[model samples]
Target chain A: MNKTIFLLMIFLSISAFMLVGCEFGKYPLILDSSVTSGAIRVDLNLPLPVQVTQTTSVNISELRNVTGESVDSMKFYNLTLLIDNNTSPNDAGITGTISVNDNALVTLTNVNISEFQTERSIFDKDLAGKGFQYHAGGVLFLLNALKTQSPDILNVTVVAGTNASSLHFDLKVKLYGQIFANTN
Target chain B: MTRKRSILFTIMSVVCLLTVLTLQVRAQNPLEDAIKQLTSENAKGYLQPFVTAFGANMNSGLYHSADISQLGFTLRLDLIAMGTVIGDAEKKYKATNPYDGSEVETATIFGEQGAIVEPIPGVQYQFQNGQVKTSFIPFFLPQLTIGDVFGTQAIIRYVPIPEVNNVPKVTLFGIGARHCVSQYIPAVPVDLSASIFYQSLEVGNLFEAKTFSLGAQVSKSFAILTVYGGLQYESMSMDVNYTYTGNIPGITVPDANVSLNLDGKNQFRGTAGVDISLALLHIFADINIGSATVISGGVGFGF
Candidate 1:
């Protein structure tokens, strides 16, 4: 009986060592709900909605696809996002980010962003309509369509107060059946 | 029809039909083939359709699976699983990594994004200190590519006219290479690659004099054209018997003493070409205005 107890103590000590090692394990970044995974190349942009106070219209075309590389087409669907307070009108700060899969920073600051998508479907091609607006103070929020299966997502933030408040959103792109051309 | 003629014709037709059927079956089996079908067919165009239509995703999927031979053995297995098949191993493979030394690596992506940036009130970005920097518009290019048969060709031979008549032997060789040309025009940089190739063409016997060749080729691309050139020096060495008149019955002369330079009499070649990327497909053409002139047109996929 004494020998069995001694063996149990030895096993417990080994388990404790493993648990401590795991505590210091290398998991610098953890994948959470806010992160997106799959990214594709698509030519789409979001023009800044009307600035509340500023006379100059905010340009939304700055947010680009991965690496800001020029994409002729892309498809994405099912996305979650967060935006800070910096996209407000009174503040000239970093642009609000549009999340694709996970990696963000899709746009730098102060640039005209426009979105255009030529979606491929089983039968015909449709154009995706996009828009953006200032949420409250300076935060800019946006959504666009990538393809029939893929939708564009944005993580919006307004850097207006003493500290920025992060906002979360889950977005899906819904396309209208008839083609809408810019008649002008 | 006469009985004799009909009988003979029936036998002959049966043989021809069998041969045609066999060839057709083999053509559908990709592993029974080299990349030549993929590469050479590319030269004739339609590579994009072949890829998109034939579940070329299988090729990419297999590549991302377990590691494969340079000849894509893993892909061949996947093709087999997909109901497409390969026949005859030895005749099919020109060169394959028999050892399967390389291991497969799995790629992972980010699961979620953690933090985000926001705007500030009454704060200026300083607008780069009111500096207006203007320069030329920058350009960009895509990465990741794989291909075989940078280039290749054949030869015929005859003995020095002793035991054999002009009915000499023929030698053949399969040539291939992996080419990577990284042109960063935005960075104004050019990375080129050059390699030496050895190939032989033979109809039957190795005893027949073998033509030895050492060839070098270099490839580069500008905005308009991609240029490549190489020299393959082929020569025949001889074992000569001399009549010194000494009459030594069993005395042999020498083994491979001198190499005959076949530069002018043998071959040299050069080429200039261009490839225009057309969204779904790409069109490429090359013209060789040199010793061994050949003009080839090719179409393939960029993805």
Candidate 2:
């Protein structure tokens, strides 16, 4: 009987502690990203054949939480556009633009392999001297517009200026922002 | 055991059983809840408040009575649980698409929209946005006290690096002293004492907390049962710095760190409880009333 009472007392004591210190909350800095990729094809026989364009759209609806709300504002600290022209023997120059709900937000012009190599070398120098080719920029205004517009859609179009049969490229964007919801 | 002792034991046993059953029923996805709260933008302002509440709860129920026998020893363990009552905040935001210079109106706290990564040509990876939500957490500590020098008892509590699943390495240490005032008045029927304690907790590099408390307590012993009451003044401070890295559907979180400092001053508290001792085994439970309600209980060996 003494042993049983001791054990019971121990159990109750632990339970009492667990019951009272039961609530807490945390606020953490968050970083999120979005990526898209596609190919652009050009035909010399076609009118305005100097340029070939490919467009794709991203749905931001899923970004909404239980409150049916999306971010009110955001800033894009890093934007990268990479083009691969190795598929074709001829070199192709590429330019790209990002739009939210059909409204243009960011435009990258004269994005080519040589320029990418040059920028990479400037940012990072190594004994190999080999560098990556990609277009990079910071667009806070564009992200703010996305938040203000609350557009459920984001569209991206990549235009390639080349005589090559096809040009393939990739686009990656990183955004940072706080989320606000209306409880009232 | 006497009739009163048996009845009190039965009541405590029933309460413990009910509490255990409630815990089983209340158990939910704590990880999901934690993530939701962390991702919410409005939760930023409430971080310090949450820490303050946590500190207050930690300071409560440290001691049941000021009575400490000269040359006596005791060992005890305590557990504390707390929850936040603050509501979530709401705000407006402006979004603009730079491509077309168009604007949109959206309502939600700020957080990462996540990223899509494709390593293979046909395979795609996407992550979801970060969200913050409120949750319940518990703290546990063990303490020891020894008395007899200069009418005072020296107290110590420690948890040498414990290995618990999902919890970081935790190290807790505390030092305190309890002085018996009744020692000077041997004819008094009531036991009187004054005590002060300081405790510090280090959970890896993610969290650190310190609390200092001073109180006076008195209890009258009747056979194996003792009823006690006390007034306490407590101060607490804490710091939290944690970073999260993971992959979720539709969103990729590369770096997410939550950091904050919390401090509280001169919180006065009142407490009352019952202590039941059978031979060397002791059981005590108490409730503290202050800025928050803190209920605590413990089992110990006293001689």
Candidate 3:
């Protein structure tokens, strides 16, 4: 009787110990989201062919609604520029610049207006010397603002080179990146 | 008195050690975070290793000895703890970037943080976070065995683990019966038995799994120690349900309900183990080799 009682007590103790404060392992958290700067209309509707620049303000506050939560840090991977040509006759030539918060990050030169749709990575050779780090920093700076639920507006200035045929097109910037947080 | 005191001390030491070891692991709410932001396609790769390893662990530790008493009343209970080793290949899988349909190699649930891949210059994709950063999957459950009438025994197992991190409670239940095969063969030197078992586990509405095993075992007793070996065919499957909260550019629907049915890689296993009986106390350990390697051990008290 004594042995049985002792064994029962031992089992109960082990069960209680196993029940309380058993922890599961924690893993890193990675969240991904895509943000886009809607089409920035660049209408070179001038009497004489001349260079034109258009500035649009874009804020990624909508990312909060997309990710459904705040994140600690973010890094952008792909940046694609989709050019929707609205004019009948395509432009002779086209070039442009992309900036974050007025800080130039990308510069396009001698771009094929006929094939204007191209994707540029942040580390693209074309964006090497053009304040690449600053562009990344500025974008992330705005993105991380979602952490505080207060996103800052990013300025995108597009410089269209001299074009003929009254070049009318819309330039849209699409960005894909990952958000990092430790929700463990 | 001295022998009894020594046994009591040993049992207490084991209990304390297990308690301390189990307490070292801390609970975090990674299950929800691991799959919540992932599309069904990506979630499958991230969680496949867990499914396989978990099933392997569940299918192990079925028996420690093949000896069955002949027409007698005997009862036993065991606290079986099992772990299935995760292979290097299982730690990672090929994941597809939902935006571009490009394949990338990323971490599984048992791996390190996922890989960030740039299929092209601008489109960077990162897979979901790995849930458990370990080399093996582990499980702990209690089993009860009662026998014998006409050289047959029945086994049952049930365990309910309390919820942590807002995840639902995890429950496991199993039933099996073993029949002595050597009883019909007169003067058999070794005890032989054939057994079949079925088990199911559930974790709230998020996960559900089932395991089936059929096998034959043989054993020989030496005083208080019994050596045993078995060959078993086992299978397991898990179903996972989660909401697709990821922002894949082409997915037109939001909050799409995603369900995955996954199977374990292990189909057969060979096991070897020894059981030591001291009065009414029993201790056993075993290792099983199959598609995955699994180790199990437990302590029990019975007559």
Candidate 4:
């Protein structure tokens, strides 16, 4: 009986160590979108509810090489969206949704662009006189979609409010998680 | 008996001399010596491996529940795996040339120079402050311990030069002594022992660390099972040295040599574990709590 109990404890301890190590070994990786000085102008005069979707692909092959695991096999944790708007007139707002390989993963609603512009200008003196906005939001639900599907391309769709016309904006995304790497 | 005593003394003396020699060489410019060989951006990642290795090495042999005399002689091999959460520690430093003191337009942010507009260049750029944040995943460390040589034990943990790996080399050696105080008391049901250990770990040319720990433990035997708990106080000192060779254009880079001495002193560690020994076969597992939570287990044989 004593031997059996000891064996059981050893098994439990090994299991706990494996689980905890896996949890803590994860590192944060930032997948940022290509930013250019040129603005992405969207004309909202065509329809009442105008949606402009910009698609960007992230190559996880390098990440796979570093981690020694396929991108699909890795676990992703926090997903954040970065929205940069460099335009004039504070009457517009944007609703952003992120999709992986056509499947919608995260949707952020009612992001006030004018308020974002005012808040950002507090730190950035360059944007103080110029009407520019910066907004960020956390998208935790993206993890489930990423696990269920193998996504190679990320699609960012920005829906402009009715007052949005000739608005210029940029979008970026970041994820934090761990991958299985070959330590040998 | 005299031969055994002489062998032990010789081993102890050599280890002490090596420790003293290492301290003497690194006492003045420890951090500078550690990082002096690091020149490229990629070499900066080598620092994380040493930190991870040290943490794993320190987490070994927490139980010490076995009385070597009762077991005749014992040898144990422990596989310790651990991960440490590295806080925001500055991993890089950069400075400009003071010879010309010529203010040049740069795209990166530098200290004190917030933002400037260059009328001639027709662009605005900030000085770059070269700082990198480094963190690593969990790794495994294998350790060996042999006990029952006149109430003393010898410990050695070594990882040979790895191929295509982040860490190049790791060597650790230590000695421990345990005294059973319960031998004098006939009515005592538990075996009590006090132990002191000293170890030194050297990771390639990056850094060297020496640790000294003192602990006391008590365990009660119940047939094939033994449960033990102990409190330990450990003091560790490390020397780090690095040099940077990469230079920014138009900025005269000075001789980049850095030396640092880090001390983790008077760390109180607590450990609790169970040992299951059936005849010559024994399996042990323990959890050590200190700056980091470490879980370790092993299987070994004794006569």
Candidate 5:
């Protein structure tokens, strides 16, 4: 009986430790290693960048009758837009435009991935953060931009602080038409 | 005056009980009821159902006492997926479809995962968009449960879950301040340990007795013959309408009355079984006639 018991014990012990002794289930879980999420400490403070492009998809010709006057929005739909790049290159590219009569407005939306990765990184690290909203010039522009034959959506971007980095967030938009008369 | 005397005597007792009952019921962020059966409590037998029933009754009853809209509604969305395991293996079981990774696995919440804990079969649901759903009776607390989840039903008290050998079972349920202990105790490092618990109870009726239970379990796991024992505190209180003989001036005949009870506990139990893991599935099923009388099988899971 003693010899048989010994053999049984030996067999069971060998099986229990077959692999490098890792418990498959029922044991408290412990991570074997750790993982980090963002970039190491880094900073860049420079003049922000700006760009403007005509989105042919946003048609303004459909707003012919809403202005209460014989006016056209399609005519001013592609005016030369002027903008301010006040953000650091490491962050967003802030830009906006004015009307042909210098009465048009320039809007600046929050900067997103396109704004932050303005330049490729030598050391890759995620820069997305809870977006900053200083109101800046965009909101003011939308409410007051005068009549124009051309209207455009200037892609806005920003770095953190007045000129911060690791700034990434996007804007969601739907185009709506309203009456506007532009005089050169 | 005599009738008034009895009412004054039991009011505090009843209030105390109701208070304790309320605290215990909401203490745990308990999961879906279906997961309860897979637990293994050594001797917490024959009173699990009463505990749950009392819990259900009290939970709904308390809501009844509070502000509940006469008309309410529910919008339910359900999802299920059939998944497989991937990981390293010991000897082999069934060579699964794409069987390369580590085989660390556990039972799925619904029938979408694993064996013994497999789905009831053939049940499917429709793909629904975010649809506006409205109804009267905004909610039915009962439907919020799987009617006897985890086999924490009337039968668990008398039935013996199978599949394991000789290892004692430990079942548990804690209410109010004690629930943290349930999660804490099992997590305590021990050589070998297992515990299970269930409760379904009904209590505080104007007529029939209100029933409730407090159960506990403890066990030590070993290579062979793991055994255990348990204790349950249970009770039922009912308001009995008895005739009150009036003897005061200007009063005539007898009137029906309402009575309540305080103080209840009628339970203690235990059991043991062998440890078995199949295809990385931790289950305790009856090796013989397949299924047992009531909840004879159980499975363990990792969060």
Candidate 6:
């Protein structure tokens, strides 16, 4: 009788304890964050026949607002640039270098202002390292700056190739991406 | 047995059971990542399915049959396994992309990854993927039932686990009673009973849940085979506490402490099952239909 009781206790204990704190499923999640450089404008005055260029800077200080801490990784997905020509003519040639955190990322080679005069104006269909004229080193520098720096900024400089004419336009850049996180 | 010795035996058995059960370790951050990714407002829809499924499972398998003894005392122990099915409707939800002010159809915590949407052409944003991608949510527990003081049975289920690794401690406690109604009737072909149960579950300080149910059951026995069915009215509610690490626009708070009180969707359920008795061993299986469908089974040893 003693042996039978002891064996019964052992069986019952093992059966009950095995079900406690037993994890049933694996859950993996991917989060997302949206980023944008608000409306920025470049203005220049023309008093001589020589061309003029001006730089406009915008502060990107709220990246951490969306990409919370303890995230596994984040990557840029689709990026686009929009321009509104306020004072410059449609036929004018615009050239400028875009920089992030004081590092030169891309230099536009006489991009025509007419391409942005349509009802829907968006540049760079392939911004995820495809068909975009961005230096690899510069792109990496920008991503690193956004990830590490608290107060990062993007600088846009526009130069008008047409002489004897003033230049003025508003520039905006939007970034969208995925953030990988695990719920373990 | 003397009353004092019986009470001492019960306490020793419960203590031994709890000590052995705490040896298992579980790793699950149930609400930590939800707050980080979905924030306060959106976390509700993302986690609603889990609350409903858990509530349905807790309300199921309360009893395999309603045949309490009318005379001498009997004791039984059961290990119940229950699962709640996840329907297609619980997979998706509509949420606003706060950055661009666009409505996007996104996945819930039990769904597939959401589709990437472009609020404005050339600018796209994606939603969070599902945390659990399964068709059913399962739960298991051990239950004890003792009976026959004037045709009534008492039921208890308790499991308390300490914090292990980084995961929090978990505790579940339930108490219930069943009364046989057929004992007062004459020439009844089926055994009839009514029961009421209340259960509470806590996961550290992050989550707390409470459920209550009142049910009526009927069963017919043929030698070693018994068939049972029941109808229950139940309700469940949960309170969640977490730190909101993600910021929302026009919201001045940072790292805000968020608390949400949510109610489960399952209100009424119908259950049907069969139980087979073999001397000292009993095995049973059942299915419940409610706001969600749940399947339950158990193995028990009884006298």
Better of 1 and 6 by TM-score: 6
> Per-residue lDDT for A31-76 in model 4, tens only?
1111111223444443444666555655433234332222334434
- Predict model 5's lDDT versus the native: 0.24
True-contact fraction for model 2? 0.17
TM, every model: 0.20, 0.51, 0.72, 0.43, 0.18, 0.66
What interface-residue Cα RMSD does candidate 1 give after superposition?
Answer: 35.6
Best of the candidates, DockQ: 3
Give candidate 3's whole-model lDDT: 0.70
**Which candidate wins on TM-score?**
3
Point out the worst 10-residue segment of candidate 6 chain B by lDDT.
Answer: B22-31
In order, the interface RMSDs are: 35.6, 11.5, 6.6, 16.7, 31.3, 7.6
DockQ category of candidate 4: incorrect
Supply DockQ values for each candidate.
0.00, 0.13, 0.23, 0.01, 0.00, 0.14
- The TM-score of chain B in candidate 5 is 0.24
* Runs in model 4 lying further than 4 Å from the true structure: A1-184, B1-53, B56-59, B82-139, B162-167, B245-255
TM-score of chain A of each: 0.18, 0.47, 0.64, 0.47, 0.21, 0.60
Candidate 6 lands at a TM-score of: 0.66
- The alpha-carbon deviation from the true structure for residue B15 of candidate 6, after best TM-score superposition, in angstroms, is 16
Clashes of each: 42, 71, 7, 20, 82, 0
Q: Is candidate 3 or candidate 4 better by TM-score?
A: 3
Give the DockQ (C-alpha) for candidate 1: 0.00
Stretches off by above 4 angstroms in model 1 are A1-184, B1-171, B176-188, B204-264, B276-283, B289-303
Instruction: Kindly indicate the candidate among 2 and 3 with the higher TM-score.
Output: 3
Better of 1 and 4 by lDDT: 4
Residues B100-205 of candidate 2 have per-residue lDDT tens digits of 2233333222222333333223222222332333333334445666665777877787755543343445567789888889888899888988889998877556
lDDT string, candidate 6, A92-176, tens digits: 5555566655666665655665554432212243232322355555566545544554345666554444432556777665554
Pitting candidate 3 against candidate 5, the one with the higher DockQ is 3
